[model samples]
Target chain A: MAGAIAGALAVFFVLSVYLLPQSYLGSIHPTRPGPIVTDVKLSQTQVVLGESFSLQVSATNSGEHADMQILSIAFPSLSSTDGIVDVQKHDFRQTPLFIKKDRAIGAGYTAQRLVPAQYPSIEASNRPWNSGETFSIELSIKPQTEGEFVIFVKAVGLPHNGDQAHWPSNGTIDHQDEFVSVYSVNVTKA
Target chain B: MNYQRGSLARMQESRRLVIGYTLVSAGILLAASGGTWDVTNHLLNKPETFFAPPHAVLYTGVASALAGMALVVSASRAAGQFDWSAKFLIAGVALLLSAGPVDFVWHSTFGLDGLLSPPHSVLVSGMVTSSIAAIIGLVRASKVLPAALIVVAILPVWISAAGAVHMFSLPFSNTAYFNFNPHPIAGAIVATLGFPLITAAISHTSSELTGRKFGILSATAAIFLFINTFTSIIPNEALVSTIPFYIATVIPFVVADAILARWRSPKSLYMAGAIVGITFFMLYYPLITHTYNKVMDNKTVWGSLTAIIYFELMGPLYPVLLAPAAAMGILGAMIGQGMVRRAILAGLR
Candidate 1:
C-alpha cells in the first residue's frame, strides 16, 4: 500500500509540474482568440550576389478583438526549419516569429545558414501594430556568399491590455504569417 | 566506537558518498550539457517545446540529481546522520524540475526573456541551491576528488549565470547581437559572487588546497566548460565558427596560483578572491578583444569597426568591472566559510 501510494504521488507531482502552468497561464492569455495572419513580401525574388533588397511585413486581425496591441516585430529563429521556406509552409511555430537570432544578415539567409548572419531585427518600433492596420518596414541586405535564402519575419506584442502579456483581447494570435512572399537570392561568384 | 565499528562506519560513509557522487555527477553532466544544447537549439530557432530532445536531456539530468540526493538522504538517515545539506539538495532539485513546465507557461502567457528570466531564475537557483547543498555533503565527507568532479560537472551553470546577467544588461553591451562578448562586466560580477564561495568550500573540504589547488580547479573547470561549449557550437558550424573560449578562461586560474601563493586565513581569502577576479579579466581582455575585433567584420551588423569601437568604449571598465569582482569574491569567501562551518555542524562530516 505504501509503495503504491508513493508511485501515485510521484506521478501526481510530475503531472502537476507540467500541467499546472498551462492551465493557470492559459487562463490568462489563452492562446489569442482565433487565427490571426501575418504577411510578408519581397521587393524582388531573384537577386545577384552582394545585392541589396527590401522585405515588407504586414498584419491583419481576423479575430473579434478590435484593439490588439503588437509589441515587437522580429526576424525568424535560428533553426533550419525556421528559414523563409519553412515559415511559409507553416513548419515553424509562430511564437518565435519574433526570433532572438542576431541581426547579422540584414535581409535573410537560407535554412542551412550557409551565410554568416540571420535577418536583421525590425527597426525600433514606430508604433504598436493595431487592428486592420497594414504597417511595413524596409530592410537592407548584403549577401557575402552565394546561395538561395529564405528570410523569416514576425511581430510580437501585448493585446488590448496594453503592456499586459496576456490581456486576452478575445482574439487569437496567428504566430505564422497568413501569407508570405518568399524570394530566392542567388549570390553569384563576384 | 570499536575498531570493527569504526571500519563498518567508514564503509557506510564511503558507500553513501560514492552513490551520492555518481548520481549528482551524472545529473549535473546531463543538465549542463543539455542546457548548452538547448540554448544552441534555441539559438538556431528551435521552438521551445516541452518535449524537445534537449529539454529531455536537461530533465533527465535533473531527475538523476534528484534521485541521487534522495539516496544520499536515505543513507544519511539510516546512519543517524540526517544531513541538512542533502535534504536541501533533494528539495531544491524538486523545485528546479518543477520550473520547467512553468517556464513554458511563462513564455506562452507573457513572452520569453531568452535569458535567465524570472521563471528561469527559479530553475537556476534550484540547481545552485541543490548543487551547493550536494557539494556541502561531499565536502563534509572530505572527498576532495569527487567534490571536484561535481564542481566540474556543473561548471556550465556558472557560465549560464554569467550569460543570464548579460541578458539583463544594457542594450549597448549586446551590440554584437551575441549573448556574450569579450568584456562581460555583469557576468564578471556574478562570477565573482559564485566562484569565490566554491573555492572557499573546496579549501575547507580539502584543507591544504587553498593555493595551487584553487588555480588547478579553475583550470580544470575552464577546460571542461570549454569542451562542452565548443561541442554545443559544433552543430552550428555552417552558421559561424567560434574562438576557443576555454583558453582565455583557464589562463587566469593558472596564473592566479602564483600570485596568491602566500595568502591564507579567512580574511586573506578575500584578497585571494580579488586576485582571482582581477586575473580573469587581465588574461581575458587581450585574448578576446583583439581576436574578435579582427574576426567580426561586415559579416556582422556591428561590423569590425563598430564592434571594436564598442570594445574601446568598454575598455575603461577593466578596473571598473574588476573592482566589483574582487568585492564579490571577498563576500563569497566570507559566506562560503560560514556555510562550510554550518555544513560541518549539520552532520555532513
Candidate 2:
C-alpha cells in the first residue's frame, strides 16, 4: 500500500512538471496547395547605407475551397540580432494576446504561441485566406551598414504544420492542392 | 502426471517463465521501435493527436511489457521465489506504462518539445529502469537464453540516455545538409546530456553481470543499440550513419570491464563511467569533425575552442559530463550491488 502511494505521487509529480501549460496552441486550419502561389518583390535590389526600402509580398490561394491560413515568417533585418538595420512589419504589441483555456483549441496546436509572435513568426494577418483570395504584406527597412544579407521566409500552409509537436512538417494533406513554401532573397549593398 | 505433488504444476510454472519472458522482451522492442518511429512520424506527419498511430504502438508495447513481467514474476513467486530484483523490474515497467497518460497530458498542455522535453524524459527513464528490471530478472533466473534476451531488451537506450537529439542517430553527411555543420548539434547533445547519463545507467544496470559476462553484455548492448539506432533512422533520412563506430566506440566497455575485474568498488565504477562517457566524445569529436570537414570542404567550421568546449566537442565532455558520469557510476554500481545482493538472498531462501 505504501509502495502504491509512493508510485502514484512520483507519477503525479512527473506529470505536473511535463504537462504543465507552457503556451497556447495555435488554431489548426485546413489549407490547400496549388495554385497557392507566393511572391516577394523588393523596391530596390541595391541600396546604399542608411537608404530605406520596401518588400511587397503577395500570396494567392487559387483553390476550389476556402483556404484557411496562408502564413509567412520574416528572418532577417531585425533590430534585436543586429544594429545595422531597422525594420517593421506586423504590430505584435497591438495584436491582442490569444488567451484560451487549455484544451479549448482543437488538436495539432503546440504549447508555444507561434503565429502571433514578436518578430520572426508573425503571420500576414489573423484573417483566413479565402478561395481565389490573396493577402499582401509590405515591410519597410533602412540599412545602417554596407553588408548584404538574405531575408528568409518560412511560409506555412494550414496543413503545413506537421502532426508531431515540433518536427519537420509533412503537409497534412487536408486539401487537394495544399502547399508549403520556404522562400528567401539576398539584397545587394551599393 | 500425479495431481498431488504435481510435476505438471512445475512444468506449467517453467512454461510460464519462458512464455512471459518472450512476450515481455518482444513488447519492449515494439515499444522502443514505436518510440523511434514516432520521432520521424512527428517530424513528417501533421501536429499529432496524443493518440497517434506510433503512440498507440508505444502504449501497446508498454502494456505487453507489464503483462509479461507479471507472468514471469508470478511463476517465480509461486516456486517460493520472488526477489527485489524482480519487484524492481515490475515497478520500472509499471512506471513506463503510467507515463502514457501523463505524456498525453503533457502534449496537450505543453505542446511539443521533440527533445526529451519533460514527461518524455520520465518515459525514457521508465524504459531505462524497466530494461534494468529485465536484466535483474534474467540474472536471478540464471538462465542463458533469458539472459541473452536481457541484452536485446536494453538495446536502443544509449541513444535515449545520450538524450541530445540524434547523438548516435542522424548521419554525419548532415553537416552539408545546409550551410551550417550539424555535427556540432550531435556532439553538443552527447557531451552535454548523453555520455554521463548513459555511463551512469551502464554502471547501475551492469551490477549482476560481472567479469567476462559484463564485458559480453556491454559489447552486445553497444552493438545491438548501434544496429537498432541505425535501422530506425537509416532508410528514412540515413540519420543512422555509421560514423561513431569507426572511432573505437567499443573501447570504453572493454576498458571499463577490465577495471571491474580487478577493482569492483564504486571508485572503479566511477572511473569506468568516466572512461565510457569521456572517451566516446574524445574520439567522436575529432572523427566527426574530420568527416564534417571532408563533406563541407571547410576546415575552420565548428573547430573553434569555443565550439570544442561548448557547441562542437571537448568542452561539455570533461568535468561537466565526466564528473557526473563518475558520480552516477558509483551510485548505479552501489544500487546494482544492493539489488544483486537482495536477489541472492531471496533465491537462497
Candidate 3:
C-alpha cells in the first residue's frame, strides 16, 4: 500500500509540474489581466487649513493583450494593513474633518463619495487604458482642520469585458483591493 | 530452543522499530503539509483563527509524532537498550508538545504577534528538531524500508530547515506592537547563506542514503516542488506566469543528481552541490522574494499581484548572488556527506 501510494504521488507530481501550465487552468484570464498602479506622486505631504494640494496617480494596464477600463479612483476609506484603526469612526461624508472638498477634479472625473462613509473621491469610466499606456488622475483637495491624516489612493477597473465570470465587478473600493498608494498628510492651522 | 526464542525476540524488535519510525515519518509529513498550507492561507489573506483547519492538521500531526515516540520508547525498553537516535526523537517530541502553552501565553500577553515572535520561533525550532529526528530514524531503519521510502523521508527535513531559515530572513515579523523583523542587510546575508546550504545539504543527504542513486535527489526535489508550488503558487491567479519558471527551475536539480550518480568522487559531489545551491532562489520562488525585500529596495505592498512583480524584479540581480550561494552550498554538502558517512561507519546502513 505504501509503495502504491508513493508511486501515485510521484505520478501526480509529474503531471502537475508538466501539464498544469499547458492546461486551461493556466490561462483562466490570459487575454485580459488586471490593472496596476505604476507610480503615484503626491504634490505635497503638508497642507494648510483652507489651502489646497493635489495627488496625481499614474496607472496602466499591465496585461499586454487588451485594454482595461477603470471604474473609480478614490482615497479608500479602509486601511489595507491589519490594524485597530476604526475607519468608519470618522465618517467624512457626515462631517468632513481633514478634507473639506475637492477644489478642482481631473479631466473626465466626477467628485463624489463611492461609499456612504468613504472619503471624498473621483470616478471615471469612459477612458480605456491601453497596453503600456499610462493615464494620470490628479485630485486637488482643500483641508478643513489640523492634524495628520493618512490618505490611501486606489484604482479599481475591469478589462473592457474581462472574464467577468472569473473577475467580478468590484462596485466599490474596499480593503480587498491591492492596487493602492498610501500617503501621510499633515494639516496645520492657517 | 533458546536460539529459536532469541531469534523470535529479535524479529519482534525489528518489527516494532519499523512501525515506530514509519508512524513518526507520517506524522512529520502531515505537520509539514499543514504548516505549508497555513502559510499560504495567511498570504492569501484568508480569515484565520486558532481553530482553523490547518492548525488542526498541524496539532493532529504533532500528536501522532508524540504517540510514535512513546511506542519507540516502549519497544526500546523491551529490547533493554536505547540508541542515540531514540534520544533525539524523544527530545524533539518534548519540544513540540511544550510549544502550545508557550504560544498561548505569548498570545494572551502580547495581544497579537508576527511570524518570528518568540513562540513561533519555538514552534519552528520544534519542527526542525522533530524533522531531524525523523530523518535520522529513517536512516537507521533503512534495512527494513525501501530506498524510495528513505529518499522520500528527506522532504520534511528540507522544509523544516527552510522554515528555520525563514525565521531569521523574512521581513514579515513586524506588527504594530513588536518589531521582530531582522535588519535588512542581516536578513539578506542570512537568506543568501542559508538557502543554498539547505538545498545542498538535503540533496546530498538524499543522494548518500541511496548509494549514489540517480533519481533520489530528483525525486526529493520533485516532491518538494509539488508541495510548495501547489500550496503557494497554483492558488493565486496573478502568479500563473511563474509556473513555467518553477518547472524550469527543476532542470538544475535533475542535472545535479545525474552528475552525482554518474561520478563517484568528492569533487563530483562538490560540483553537484554547487549546481543545486545556485537554485536556492528559484526553488523558493514567490515566498523567497520577501527575503530580498530590503536588499532590493522593494516598497510595494505584499499581496499576490505585487508578489509576482517583486519576484520578477529579482531576475536582474540574481546573477550577482549565484556565486556566493554556490560556495555556501558546497560547504553544506561537505558537512551533510560527513554526517551520512559517520552513520554508515557506525553500522546503521
Candidate 4:
C-alpha cells in the first residue's frame, strides 16, 4: 500500500512537471488605442522676417477605430502676449487639444483646410475636429527686429475611441517639434 | 518534591518556548508585511487596486500576524514538548504560500494587463525558505504532529491546482499562466507539499537503515528532488510550467503520508530534513537575485557546496543538492534539526 501510494504520487509529480511546459495558460488581451495626431508639417524651413509661413496641421484616424470628439489640435499661442512668436521661440506648450466631432468637417469624412497664422482669429478654440481625417492651417511669421528667429510647429490629438488619449494637449508629447527659421532680409537701395 | 521540580522545569521550558516563538513570529511578520508592501509596489502597475482605502492592507497584515501568533501559542500549549522553532518554521511557510494567492486574486480582480508581470523575487525567496523550514520542522517534530502538518500542507496544493486550472480555462485568459510566470500562491502550495514528502521519504529510508522512524526526513528529501526535477525540465522563460510541478509536488506528499502512517526516530528524521533543506537552499541561491544580472550568478555556489558537504559527510556527492533549490531545502532542514536536537537534549537532561 505504501509503495503503491508513493508510486502514484511519483507519477503525478512527473505528470505535473510535464504539464508545466504547456503554453497559453495565462494570456491577457490587448488594449485599444488611446489617441493620435498626424500630418504635422512646416511649409518652409527658412523664411524672411515679417513674411508668411504656413504650418499645415491635421488630425487623423490612425487608431483601430474612429473615435468621436478627439481633441486633435490646438494652437494655444494665438492667445499669448507674444502670441505665436513666443511659441516659436520656446516651442508650443503641449496642451490637450479638445476634439468635438459633432461639428463635422466638410464631407464628414476628411477635415482639411488652411488658416492664416498671422491673424489671432485662427485659434484652436475656432477649430474642433475628429480623427480618421486631416486638416491644415497656415501661419504668418513677423520677426520684430530679428537677427534669427525660430518658430515651432506642433500637432496633438487622440483617437476617436473612448480610451484615454495618449497625447496631452498641454505639453509637448514626447518633445516632438518642428522649427521654422526666420532670417531678416535687408532691402538696401541697390 | 519531584512533581514540584518537574513543574518548575516545565515552566522554564515553556518560557523559553514563548521567547523563541515571539522572536521568530516577529521576524516573519516583519518580513512578510514589509516584503508584501515592497512586492505590491514593484510588481503591480496599479497598486492602488489592492493597497487603496477600503481594503486596508495594514489590517490584513495585523490579522495575519495575530493568526500566526495564535497558532504558535496553541501548538506550544497543546504539546508539552512542542518545538516552538518548528511551529515558527511552519507558520513562515504558510505565510509564504498565502502571499502567492493574495497577489494572484488582487491582479485578477483589478484588470491588470500582465498576469505575471514584474515577478516578486523577495516573495519567491520567502516561499522557498519558509518551505524548507516547514519540512525541517515536520521531520524533527513528533509523529502525530508531522502527520497533521502533512494534511494541512496538502489542502493548499489541491486548492492552488484547481484555481490554476480554472484560471487557465477562463473565457478571457490572461498571460499569467505562461511558463516562468511567478504565481506566488501556487509556488507556495507546491513548496508546502513537495518539501514535506521528500523529507519524509528520506527520513523513512534512513530510519529503516538505522532501525528508526524518520518519515519527515523522507518527505523533505522527496520534495527537494521533485523541485530540482521540475527546475531541470522547465526553464525560467516558461511561466506556465509551474502548474504541473505544483500538482506533482502535492500528490506525492499526500500519498507518502497515507502510506507511511507515522514517522519514527525524530533524530534521524531531522537529519534527513536538514540534508534536504540545506541542499535546496544552496541550489536556489543562484536564482534568488532580484535582477537577472548574468555577471553575478551564484547557482554553482550551492552545487559546489553540496558536492563538498555530501563528500565529507556521506563519502559521496549524494547529488541531492544538485537539484534546483535542493540546497535551500537541505540548509533549512539542517537548521531545524539542529534546533530540535538541542531541545531534545535539554529535555533529556
Q: How many residue pairs clash (N, CA or C atoms closer than 3 angstroms) in each of the candidate models, in the order given?
A: 13, 15, 0, 94
Off by over 4 Å in 2: A1-190, B1-8, B36-57, B73-94, B105-129, B142-147, B153-211, B231-247, B258-273, B280-311, B315-338
In lDDT terms, which candidate is top?
3
Instruction: Give the C-alpha miss distance for residue A68 in model 3, angstroms.
Output: 19
Compute DockQ for each candidate against the true complex.
0.03, 0.03, 0.05, 0.14
- Backbone clash pairs for candidate 3 read none
* Model 1 residue B67 distance off true place after TM-score fit, in angstroms: 2.3
Q: Rank order by DockQ, top first?
A: 4, 3, 1, 2
Query: Which portions of model 4 show Cα errors greater than 4 Å?
Result: A23-190, B1-34, B37-41, B48-248, B252-335
lDDT preference between candidates 1 and 3, better one? 3
Candidate 2 C-alpha lDDT tens digits along A9-85: 34432332122111101121223433233577778777776677776666554442321343443444443324332
Predicted complex 1: DockQ: 0.03
Candidate 4 chain B: 10-residue stretch with minimal lDDT: B289-298
Per-residue lDDT over B164-215 for candidate 2, one digit per residue giving the tens place of the 0 to 100 score: 3342432322211122234544544444454445554544455354432445
Instruction: Give per-residue CA lDDT, model 4, range A1-190, as digits (tens).
Output: 6467557745753453233222222231112333444555665655565564545444443443222223223332333324333223211212223222222232111222222232122223111232344433434444444343433333322121233333333443211221122222231221
Name the 10 consecutive residues with the lowest summed lDDT in model 3 chain B: B300-309
lDDT score at residue A24, model 4, on the 0-100 scale: 20
**Best model per DockQ:** 4
